[model samples]
Target chain A: MSRASWQAFREGAYHTLPLILGAIPFGIIFGTLGPASGLSVEATLLMSLLVFAGSAQFIALGLVATGTPVGLIIAVTFVVNLRHLLYSITLMPSVCHLPLNWRLTMAFWLTDETFAVAVSRMAPEHRTQFHWYYLGSALAMYGNWQLCTLLGVTAGQWIPGIENWGLDVAMAVTFIGIVVPQIKTRPKLLCAISACCLSLLWHDWPHHTGLIAAAIAAVVLALTAETMGQKKETSLKTGSKTT
Target chain B: MTEFILIVGMLAATYFVRLLPFALADRMRLPAILENALQYVPIAVLSAIIAPAVCLPEGYFWIDWKNPYLMAGLVSVIAAAIGRNLVITIFAGMATALSIKFLIV
Candidate 1:
């Protein structure tokens, strides 16, 4: 490989290793649960490939297990994945200059992990290359997900003690690790707390609509807190001039 | 026929939701309030998933010494917040959860 290509490949590999490791147990759990959830092997594998989202796919699987109506399941999945809209919005300005094929390919691989790594590392100047890096990270995650799901499906019941293995906590831990550092302000803290409370209160809502509502509530709360903070700061500055 | 239609509809709906913001951002200038709202999206979505998973273990709201998952999750959150390392935090959380499950239940 050329020097730049090698660097990109290496960067992608290094960035994706942790995500793959985190995803393995998750994939295995999904595989183990798929049959019990009444999903055929082909359907399970297809869902993994097509959805490629860990949490939302699990939520969909749970709904499917309960024999939810097809329309409700589809609607819930759509709502559960609404956060991806935010992701695409954040990434578009950075990746717009890329070729159409590359843009679409990167879009296909866009998940929380890949987007996190890509957005965090993107520089203001070399934003064009952000898509390449995103492609590398996302493609690596995609490969791991496919392989792990294949392994899980083939092994099936033979893959013992997956629940006991504590793989489910991996995603939560990873999320907390990613999000805690970013909660550097009061408004962000309020957003987190309010969202958690709202979701808990509305957990029984059908189609997981409570989640979407909680997300909306958090954004509103944060915006309000931010505006109030700004007003206070402005008032303080004006009062200091009189004093 | 129903299953096929369901899958197609799901694919369309998911893609529409994912694409909507990008299309809007391209066509119109978003207000500052909307931009700030976007900033809270990740945390809100994440907490929405995490809270119920941790708080409701038996399909109901039950919190007590018997529930190790919640205890472990709390510890895991604290550790992650303080440690800020993905591998360490995950390992700590998993280990705590497993140990608690085995010991308590």
Candidate 2:
């Protein structure tokens, strides 16, 4: 609300400009897919506004199209979004000083892009208005997503079977883009590889539960890999220290 | 009505998952092991979603011999790894997939 905070906020929004460009196609696709998946326009918009998770929304649409039980749909989406918990954990130290409401807003607005942008922008430890900057980025992404969803919904009616045009492949590629940068470590690479293989192997599982199983497997493997890594690092440190 | 509840359910679940950590993160410290595991959640989950979607586009168990989706996905991944850009990765993947799909299929 202060001038400095306002400026930080605006700057955060400005940082999201490139991310917004990437998000436009995704949002439009979600909107286009929603109606084609048999969701009413209102329902699709409402989902975008309230749920606000692109991947989860897409999974929900797939499950809904298959007439999967509501409980199953909810479960699948919940598991898919469990990654946000990690984002909050990563971000907690940076914004721990903020009040509960601000924290809640940040969490609600947290997405892959916003988290990546906001975390990078929070370098100045002494700065008081980093939360405002985060809010700016979050709000920018949030607004862009909703607008693109709206456009996708409107464009959906005029375009038939737009969902079947292999666009989901693009999403898969987007997943690759997200994965490649993060696999800098052996554990991360293993986690990614195992999860990918298991996902294909588990593809036949009922109720789309394979995703959760694959994720859990990946996490378990990653933990094992990381613990071994830590042990090795500590031993090396101790060895060097003694010598 | 069912759709609305589903939407609400999704909203509640998403907020709840995203919110609990934000709220509790300050109150409690995550264990070191748990913290390390949590770090992998994003990569694991994204791969879990992408692998099947690309490898088995048609159904629970399906793989085309040439696998245009798979081929295109690999191209995209290579493009992204080399370019370090999302737009280029997506466009390149899309372009590869569409061309293979049209040319071969």
Top model number, DockQ: 2
Q: Which stretches of candidate 2 lie over 4 Å from their true place?
A: A1-22, A66-76, A116-130, A206-209, A229-243, B1-3
What are the per-model C-alpha RMSD values against the true structure? 2.8, 3.4
Expressed as tens digits, the lDDT of each residue in B26-54 for candidate 1 is 44555655655666777777777678767
- Work out the TM-score per prediction: 0.87, 0.82
Per-residue accuracy of model 2 over B1-105 as CA lDDT, tens digit each: 998999999988899988887787567777776755666777887788788877888874556547777887789789978988877887888888888777777
Q: After superposition, how far is residue A126 of candidate 1 from its true place, in Å?
A: 4.5
lDDT, candidate 2, A40-70, per-residue tens: 9999999999999988898898888888899
lDDT scores for all predictions?
0.72, 0.80
TM-score of structure candidate 2: 0.82
Once model 1 is optimally superposed onto the true structure by TM-score, how far is the C-alpha of residue B79 displaced, in angstroms?
1.4
Task: Give each prediction's DockQ, rounded to 2 decimals.
Answer: 0.54, 0.62
Q: What share of the true interface contacts does candidate 1 keep?
A: 0.53
Interface RMSD of each: 2.6, 2.6
Cα deviation of A229, candidate 1, in Å: 1.4
Report how closely model 2 matches the true complex, as a DockQ value.
0.62
